[model samples]
Target chain A: MTRFALTVEFDGRPFMGWQRQSHGPSVQQALEDAVHAVTGERTAVHAAGRTDAGVHGLAMRAHVDIAKAIAPFRLMEAINARVRPAPVAVLDCVEVAPDWHARFSCIRRSYEYRIVNRRAPLTHEAGLAWQVPQPLDEAGMADAAARLVGRHDFTTFRSAHCQADSPVRTLDLLSVERVRDRLFIRAAARSFLHHQVRSMVGCLALVGMGRWSPDDVEVALHARDRAQLGLNAPSDGLFFVRADYPDEG
Target chain B: MTRFALTVEFDGRPFMGWQRQSHGPSVQQALEDAVHAVTGERTAVHAAGRTDAGVHGLAMRAHVDIAKAIAPFRLMEAINARVRPAPVAVLDCVEVAPDWHARFSCIRRSYEYRIVNRRAPLTHEAGLAWQVPQPLDEAGMADAAARLVGRHDFTTFRSAHCQADSPVRTLDLLSVERVRDRLFIRAAARSFLHHQVRSMVGCLALVGMGRWSPDDVEVALHARDRAQLGLNAPSDGLFFVRADYPDEG
Candidate 1:
């Protein structure tokens, strides 16, 4: 069997997230089915991150094992053909060692959340951004977001049902900036717990609107309780931007 | 009656066009209906430009007359509330003199066309951009676009059914630039014939792809014949960005 690593991009609006579920279609299921259709082998596909429903991916990494030996480009073409009409595409494909795993071998992951701060309703970016009718103080949001960076027990920012063994995670980056009428929050880490990024954005949004202060975020982080967290931001604004693998370069 | 000028935004994917028609809902119809719902007065709304189906707008200018003297902010809020789930919004409203026509009084109009040049199926920007699965030489495209700037007879790029009395028009600007994998083509003019911007982009895309040279654009412009034009690019990627009025500021 040969292992192939693929970079994928998808609109998560229609799927039930990246992982396979019994209820509806998933990005994993769609890709696995496409692989089966192309190679006639039932192979499982693993993603670097399992994003939630309504989230988007600019560059997601995945790995699949198959019995047939085919060129990476040919595999991409065949799989894309089978996955017709779905808003998913393989951006790049590369042959990798058989032991490489998409999820386990990943070293870093990055996400971006977008908020359009304007009085008008979103038209072109309707489902792709979080719309805040009132103006947001981006500098204030940045100040609040800065408090979450570095190593911390992010329990307040994590989902109640997150299955991670520990709440402590090292956040490599947390930044907020304004471009035109949009506020962008970028976060990067080795990994994340369920709803961690969204929860953090939600808190920062409150700070942006003058409802919360920088000290509030610090207190919430120290509280180490999910109830202390702000409202979770909608999944629509979140985008899984990239996954980094060691030894790739 | 008081005359009001409104600045609007919309995602035109579901609408027939900017003009009202029996085939499907139009942006004009939606605005007029919302106005009537809010004020109980039927008013004729006239826009500066008529965009095709699937074309979005950022700041379209329109004028309407209403019997009641309503505050601009309240009128904006009321109309937006009554628009009813449509992908349309009245961004701003201002009182104008009765003779200030939306179409005739406009001094300049600007448009932006987006093309995502990459070998991947679009996910987040499906309907908002034209997806071309190939690498485009942006420098070549920019060079070719410069040839179309300034006053000229645009018959080669004008639609066959365009009703403009003369094909001659002064193009204030036509610029092509690349940001990552996305190509932005911005055009400015006092007025344009049907399909003018799209036709220009279609030809520039050819230059970007190495299918044509910069001189070819000059030759096509001089041809001044519709038959000499490139294919009309899809309307989905075009945006009616803004319209300028002299006295608005």
Candidate 2:
């Protein structure tokens, strides 16, 4: 048996997040089916992060184990060829150490949220980005975002469905910048609580719209109550940017 | 009657082209229908450029005459509301002089062609960009593109079915730049013949891939023969960026 690491990119509009589900299609089921078609094995596929529905993946890290004796390149090609019509592609594939895990061995993960600040309705970026009709004060949003960058109890920013045992996580980076009419919020950390990025982005947007202040964010963080949460941004603008492993640069 | 000029943006994948067609849906038809639904006037919509099938528009300039007296803001909102699920939007609108024509009064028009230089299949940018599997040397493509800048007889690049009275047109700018794995080709001119930008990009792609030299591009331009053209790129990546009028700035 050999373990192969795969770098996958997908459009999340059609899938029910990254995990397998009985009610709807998912990225994991599609990849697993493709692997079955290629190798005749029902090998399980594990990803570094399980994204929510309508969340895009730019370079998601994943790993799959197969007992079939096949080259990495051939397996990648065969799987890609079999995954027809699905909006998923394997960008890179390589053999990895048996002990390396896609989820546990990963050290860091990065995500980006896109917001198109405009009054007119979106055309090219309809589903790809979240459109905010009001003009945003990006500098204000940046100021408010800094208050949430350090270690704190993120209970107010987590979803009710979050299953993580701990409410505290170290946030390495949280930045907000505006380019023309588009606003980008980038976040990086070892891991994140469920809906943490979206919830943080929602409060930052309120700041951008002049509904909240920097101190409000810090106050909310200290409250540690989900009822005190400002808002939970939609899943349309969320993207899993990449996952960083210690072995690979 | 009041003449209103509109800055439009659309995803061109669903429509046959910008012009009205009997066989397939067109952007012009959608706009005209929306105007009729809003103002009860079956007016014609004229555009600065008639893009080919599968070509997108970023900020295409167009105009329509409405007999009803309505505020520009209200008219824009009404039209936007009426054009549902069409992948088209009016970014801006304003009243214009009766003599100001969308097609005739335009001083310059700009276009952008996107090429994703990679071997992996596209997911998010499926119909938004052209995927070139081979590696491209953008510097070489830029050098070849420079040869096409300036006034010249471009019969070699004009389409066989082009209706322009003459093959002579001044190309104001042609530039190629690579940002990461994406290549951007920008072109601007007062007007263009059919298939001119795509034809130029196709030949430049050959230069980037080492199949043709810069001299070959110049030789083809001088040949003044349609058969001498190297290739014509697909319409998927072409975008009508914007149209410039003298009085706007």
Give model 1's DockQ, 2 decimals. 0.72
DockQ comparisons of all candidates to the true complex: 0.72, 0.76
- Weakest 10 consecutive residues, lDDT, candidate 2 chain B? B118-127
lDDT of 1 by residue, B61-133 (tens): 9999999878988999999888868899988898999999999999999999999998777777778899987
Give the alpha carbon lDDT tens digit for every residue of B1-249 in model 2: 999999999999999999999999999999999999999999999999999989999999999999999989999889899998898998888999999999999999999999999877788888899888889989889999999999999999999999999999999999998999999999999999999999999999999888999999999999999999998988989999989999988
Residue clash pairs of candidate 1: none
What CAPRI grade goes to candidate 1?
medium
Taking all chains together, each candidate's TM-score versus the true structure is 0.97, 0.98
- C-alpha lDDT of residue A114 in model 1: 94
True contacts kept of 1: 0.72
Clashing pairs in 2: none
Off by over 4 Å in 1: none
Can you tell me the DockQ of model 2? 0.76
